[model samples]
Target: MEVAQFIIQILNGLSYGLLLFLLAAGLSLIFGLMGIINLAHGSYYMLGAYLGLTIMKTSANFILALVGAATLVALLGLIMERVFFRGLYKQELDQVLLTFGFIYIFMDLAKYLWGGTPRSLPTPPLLEGSLEIFGAAFPVYRLALIVSGLAVALLLRLFLEKTRTGMIIRAGVDDKEMVTALAINIKLYFSIIFALGAFLAAFGGVMGGPVIGAYPGLDFEILVLALAVVVVGGLGTLRGAFWGSILVGFIDTFSKALFPSFSMLTIYIAMALILILKPSGLLGRMELS
Candidate 1:
């Protein structure tokens, strides 16, 4: 492979990794704060892709599709939290079973509503172009995706590190009972976090639509990847999600280039090795109780 090709590959991996970071970051936050292993989390992404596509087709507005899809997803998440997940807190088996059931339900809905056909969200006209990189014409859209992911990361860090709500959230993660004792509406925060997770998943999906497309079984594939990110990046830290996504993204991308047939196998092997070396993950802290 030439240097240009390798550089392009690196950019590809970085773009993909950043998507995974935002996607997995939501899962990590939810689990860290709420102890919920939401098996159906990927459905948020799937639905977002399909819905965003629909919105774009109807309105021809990319920004609308993104915000609209994410908002709808967040609303659904709130409903799930209030209607189902609220009662299942700390009940691991129940949570798993409930969320797993929703996955099937979502799959069926996607099929019925969108059909089995795969679809791709077209790149916005404003972003339709390429940039020369190492003499390679890398898609400008991809670079935009990378920048968007990084910007969101920065915003999230600020939200979690600087804001009063963020401080409350962190304190809640440390000790919910104590936070509750302080008369803070921790329950409302839980709902907010759950909705926020769903929103992030949806945002990732719409942004990734042009690259990965909307299709059946994509949810499960994303779920596996997100789970892998969490496992490798540790349970809940944003730092862990960032580094883990980059590492996993690079390994997965390069392995696919070299051995397409055994790409997933390579990822698993890398994950196993990392686990053996550091069980909790590179920058992961003690799991929140």
Candidate 2:
């Protein structure tokens, strides 16, 4: 391949990797801290895309769509946690079943609301065109995605490292019983984390909508990729999630470019190799199942 083409592919991979990180970050946080297997997480992403599409279509404001979609999904997550998931704490099987049930409900609701046809959000005018990078034209929207994902990651890291709530959350993850015994409102904390995770997933959906489009089966497609990211990156570490996403993104993108026939198989092969070599993942603290 030409150098410019290779550079473009790398940029594409980086953009995609960042998107994966956004999707997986919440899943990593929830699983790591709460041990809850949230199967409906992907549904939240799908909802975000649909909601964003609606908002953009009606208002022609991309920023509003993003904020509105994320906020709504976050609220839904809070409600789900308080009403449905709170009682199911530590009951992994029940949590899985309940979330799985929600997946179907969400899918049905989406179909009813938006019909079966796929939809896509229009890129903002500011990010509508392309720019030359290494003599190659690259989409501005994609570059924006990469920047947004990185900025969010940085902000998240700062929040977790510098804020009191972040410290408490970290402590809770280390030992939930100990944090609860200290009179901390562990339940409230969990709720907040759950909501935050939902927000991130939704935000990712909005950001990714232009690239991937909003489709009926989008939830499952992204869900599978997000799950792969979480598993490959290690269950509980944000650092792991970041690196894992980049690795998967590059592997998938480059394989598609260089070996079209093997693209589908490459990522799985990478995952299997990683598991064999480093069962806990590159930066993950938890063991693989």
Give the TM-scores of the predictions, in the order they appear: 0.96, 0.97
Model 1: which ten-residue window has the lowest total lDDT? 280-289
For model 1, residues 1-289, the per-residue Cα lDDT tens digits are 8999999999999999999987888888887778777888899999999999999999999999999999999999999989997787668679778989999999999999999989999999999999999899999999998999999899989999999988888888778889999999887888988899899999999999999999999999999999888778887788888888888888888998988997899778877876888877776765433
lDDT of 2 by residue, 184-206 (tens): 98989889889999999999999
Candidate 2 has its poorest 10 consecutive residues by lDDT at: 280-289
Off by over 4 Å in 1: 287-289
Cα lDDT of model 1 overall? Answer: 0.89
Q: How accurate is candidate 2 locally (lDDT)?
A: 0.89
List candidate 2 stretches off by more than 4 Å. Answer: none
Among the numbered candidates, top lDDT falls to 2
